[model samples]
Each structure stands twice: as structure tokens, then as C-alpha cells.
Target: MVDYSILQKKYLVGTYVNRGLTFIAGEGVHLKDATGAAYLDLMSNYGVAIFGHGHPAVVERLTDQVRTLTTLHGSFANDRRAEAARRLTVRCGGGLARVFFSNSGSEANEAALKFAVLATGRRRFVACRRGYHGKTLGALSATDGRKFREAFEPLIWDVVFVPYGDIGALEAAVDDATAGFIVEPILGEGGIIVPETGYLKLASEICRARGALLLVDEVQTGAGRTGPFLASESEGIAYDILTLGKGLAGGIPFGATLVSRDVGERIPRSSHTSTFGGNPLAAAGVLAALDLLDEPMADHVRKVGAYFMAGLEAIGSGEIAAVRGRGLMIGVEVRSRRDDILKKLQDEKILAIPAAENVVRFLPPYVIRESHIDDALAKLAGILSGLSAGSPPPCAAS
Candidate 1:
């Protein structure tokens, strides 16, 4: 067996409690560890691997772009960056006509915040409780997790946290003095809690009425993860500022905050920028990702998502609490043994993520096959049956 414990102990940051699987390679929707053991990738690298690992289209574009131009500051114009911005705006399918590129979801959100301040001239912004934007100072201020934000108190003074899905609370929070309201259409990292249909529309109306902008953070739920180009688009809501990441480059680091033409006209050019933002290599990958995500693949995700949800429901027993989420983003709530169940699933060669509400999150890549879903269900059923009988999960790590 390949030994990695010493390397992990020496170099890895201990902030994240890893699952102990050292993936050495991947193709399509499956990953192989150093020991050659295989696992079906259901977590999708926390929703980054939208098209799965090592997709041919993305790989080819990245290879070609590296030879041509890999790193350049955003000051100069590049063909790939221009094409990527055009493709993104065309896909947005609304009045959103301008794009600001960044390297990660956090930076994308930070750009949106800066745009909000520039457009509204207000310092205050509002976000929902338990909503996660990102970890940067500005984005972290917008995120609502106490555990993540507690250490950094005094984030941004004007930032406010309100109950998600509560129109009244959102309305009360946003006033004429507010800069913008940032929200996740579907709470992705907060356990796949999709709000009611009109919740977003109502929030947008409130923000507009109060002279504040609405910014939708689709970082985790965008780019076919939710059967649409973006979760906000699926809900039939348009925002003044929209952020996209996670799946933008099919696992490559790429993020964008699109500003409506009206919002774009208000901001100056030098107000915000990133050194590696919209670099040619990442741009080529983004362009290829956009091209590959056509209508047929999106339709497949919708059908397969329904099928997967049904399978999970059919396996439900008293030990299972609830199943929720939309498209391919699913969450399974259990009455007990959440951690133990996750370890058991790992041992059974299935990958899943733990949610804040004791829920198991399944964010499989868009390329996951029907057979993969079936195998995941069967393995999960075996684990659940064993756990329900009061037997401790045998594979749980110390």
C-alpha cells in the first residue's frame, strides 16, 4: 500500500477533517485511489467537477491554451477572455450584458459587493442566515455561518443576517440605505434547502423597491448542477448582479460576476480587479465548458435527477427522516448515525458530503450514469439496513 500519512501530517492543513481517501486519478464519474480501489464520485469535489474529472473537452482546451497563453494580467485584452465573456453573457439570457471575471467564487462575490457599493452608494448589505458566500473578508462577511465567521467578528459592520425564505424579514432588513441583498436561490452548502417558487421574485421586488440591488450567488448551483444554467434562472428571477463559479470551467478555477448593463455603467474600470482574473488558460476552459453544456445534457440531468430522488424515497424507512433538493443536488436526512453512515458509504465505495443539518449531500457530476445511481442506492440501502439494526458501522475510522 502507498503510504501518505507522513506527507499529510507534514504539509496538509488540518482545518478540514479529510475522509482519508487519497484519490490518485479519475475519469468520467469514478475516482481511483493510490491503492487502485475505485469509488463512484458523488460529491463531485464539493460541486466543482460538474462535468466530472478530466473531461476531454476541458482537458483539450486547457492543453491548447497553456501552449498559447497561460498567465496574463486582466489589463490587456485576450481573445479567449473576450470569447468567454461573450459566451457567458449570451447564456445568461436576459438583460445581464457585462461580466467581471475572477478566479474563485469568493472573488466573484467580492466583485459583486464592490459593484453594489458603487451603484447604490450604500455601505450595508443583507444576507440570509446559514447562507455561505465564501471565506474572504468581504464574502465571509456576507456568509451567515457562525462557526466560519465567529473567529472573525467585526466583519463588515453594515452586513445583516436575516431568516432565509422570510419575505417580511428580508423586506425589513433592506431599506433605502441598503447597498444590496445577496442570497442563494437554493442553499447549496447549507444543506440543499430550495426555497419556495416566488421567494426569490419577492426578494428581488423588495430590493428594487428599497433602492438596493439583488445579487444571486449561484456559485454551487450553477452550470447544469441544477438542470439549468443557473439556479436563479430556473426560479424565473433575474438579479442586478449574478455570480457563477464551481462548475464554470468543469473543475478549473473560474468565476464570474455578471453586472446588468445599468449596473455596469455606474462603476469605474479600476474599482476592482484580480491579477489572474480571466487569464487565457482558464478562459479557454470556460469557453469549452459553455459549449459542452448544451440543451440535451441539461434535459438528461432533469430526468436523471427525478429518477435518483425517487430511488432514494423508495429506500426510505423510519430511520430515514427526509429527502430534499432539486435537479441533481440532493440531500438525505437521517434520524441517527450521520457520521457513521458517511464512513460506511465510503467503505462501500460511494462518496457523499455531510450537510450542516445532519443531512447527506449528493452532488454527483452531470455525467453520472443510471447504473452509477443504482449502485449508489444499493450500497446505501445495505448500509442503512445494517445501521437500523443497531449494529455499529464497521468501517468508521478512529
Candidate 2:
């Protein structure tokens, strides 16, 4: 077994202060170390492994596609790309027919921002406070988190930030010069914050009224993660442009920006392109993942998420501030030491992620069962008890 800690320190970039674990492999709802100890994966690779690790459907399609055609430049149209586009449009519905494929959620958002620019011929975009879009320059400009964007002080020109769920603030920010209003239907990185009811519909209406495009960033919430093909459907919202990734291809690293036909036509050829985007392998993976999303998977997340959220609330633990989210994209805010609790869960053979601030995020795979939830809760309860007893866990030392 390789102690990756040493090698990681020497070669890997220190962008993330990573959790100290050397996970070797994974299966549905579980990851295994070199010693073959299983850990229930609540994180789901930060919402990428939607069907969980090594899902048969995603695996088979990915394998077959690699043998047939691993990749192709975006210069030519391919069969897989065409089929993938068709499937995505049918799933999204409402005239969102054109797709620009990319390698990740950030790239997808970047594409969407560019589309908004071309379609409106405007420079200004309005994004909500605490919303996360992506890390790229354009997407970063739309993202509201200061930690991610502070280093790159001057981002794209003429971006505005408003309080999420405040219709009046949205009304004030968007105007004639506004090209788009980008938002996450449910904020994932910003503590899994769900907007107030009717907020999305109202925002869409306002954007339309002002001749500005409404762009939804569903990077972490879309593709069955929120018990829907797209999370915006819950609000009956229709976006002029939509960005999706993080389990779009079930961990195979594919993202897409779906735009309205009119908006799509506004952008000229070769305006924006990626060498590795729209490859056959990724397209096949998305096709397979979408097929899986059509089954009991979506239902499973909705049902399980309700049960889990209720259980979290029932615990009534002093350490927990609140539990919020839809479907399986849950976030638990704690006043106590989050890193310590997260490490305790990890030690107990369950994995979770720390989100912005004191938020402990649970983005378990869509295929996660009741047993996994029970196990996670049990471990979490024990840690919470310890924290309440005024004992700091081991990870706090780190």
C-alpha cells in the first residue's frame, strides 16, 4: 500500500487542505482503502458520483465508448454528441435545445456566461450573495463567495451581487445594461441554502421583463441530485441558459450549457470552444446516466432525503444549528467544531464534506440506501455527543 501522504505533499498542489485519507477504490455508496476497509461515501466525490462509484450502467457505457472512440475535437459533430444533446434537451424541456459541452461545471458556466453576453450584447451580470457558480474567470465573476474570488480581485466587468431570496434587491440590481442574472436554484457550496418559495419564479419573471437572461447554475444540484433532472423545475422556473455538471456523466467529467435556441443562434461559430469538450466517451456516459435518472433513482433521493432530514431535525443536538437542502444535497450547520465532527465520521467509516463556514455537507450518492443513512446518523450523533460534552475530536489538532 502506498502512503500517498508523502507523495502527495511532494507533487500535489496545496489548493485544498485535503482530508487525510488514501481511498483506493469505490462502489455504490462506499469507498475502500488499500486495506479494504469500507467507508460509506456521503460526499459522493463532491456530488460527482451521482450513481455512486462503479455503477454498472455508467461503467459499461464508458467502457464501450472508450473502445469505439475515446475522444474527438469539438470541430466536428459526432453521433454521441448529437444523441447526448437530444437527451439533455428532452430532459430539460421548454425549448432549451442547444448544448455546448465542456469538461467540468466551471467550464459549463463559463460557456453559459459567454452565451448570455452574445445573446444580450451586454456586459453586466447580477448574481446573488452566497451563491456559487464555478471557479473560472467568468464563472468566478458570477460566484459570490469572497474566498474563491478575492485573489483575483478584478474579475469580468460590471458584475453585481444581491441578497438571495430578496426580490426587491434583485429588482434593484437588474436593469437595461444587465445581460444576465445567474443563480443556483439551490445554493450548494453556500451551505445548501434553498431560496424562499416563489423566489426563483419571481427572479425569472423579473429577468424576462428586463430583457435579461435568467441563467441557472445547476452544477451541484442537477442530474437527479435534487430529485429532479434539473432543480429549477421545482419552482416551475425556465432559464434562458442552464449550466449543469457534477454527475452529468456520473463522474466521467462532463458538463454542458443548454441555451434557448434564440440565444444559441446569437453566438457565432468558434466563439468559444474546448479541445476536450463533447468527446464520445463523455457523451456516452451522460446518455447512460440520464437513462438511470429516469428510473427509481430520482424518487429514491426525494424519499430518502426527507427521511434523513427529519432524522437530523429529530436529533435536536445542541451542536447542530440547522439542517437544510432538497433531495440528497443536505447541509448541516453546527456551532461546534466542524472539522472534528467530520473526522469523527470519517473514523467511523462514513465520509462527509465541509462546506462554506460551519456547514457540514452530505451529498451522498443517489443510490444510497436507508442503511447508509442510519449508519451516517449514528456516527454523527456520537460525535455530536462528544462535542456537547466539551471534548474536541482528534482532527481539531490538524
Q: Rate the local accuracy (lDDT) of all candidates.
A: 0.88, 0.88
TM-score of each model, paired residue for residue: 0.96, 0.96
Candidate 2: worst 10 consecutive residues by lDDT?
389-398
**lDDT score of residue 389 within candidate 2:** 77
Candidate 1: which stretches are off by over 4 Å? Answer: 391-398
lDDT of 2 by residue, 1-398 (tens): 56787789779888877778888899788999888999899998899988889998888899899889978887777999899999898899867978999999999999988899999999899998888888889889988877898999899867999988899999999998999999988888888898888888999999999999999888898898889788788677666899888888767888899998889889999899898888899999888988898757788889999989988888889899999999998999998688988888888988899888899999998888887788788778888987787755558957
lDDT of 1 by residue, 205-231 (tens): 899888999998988888888888877
What is candidate 2's local distance difference test score? 0.88
| lDDT (Cα, 0-100) at 281 in candidate 2 | 90
lDDT of candidate 1 vs native? 0.88
Q: Spell out the clash pairs found in candidate 2.
A: none
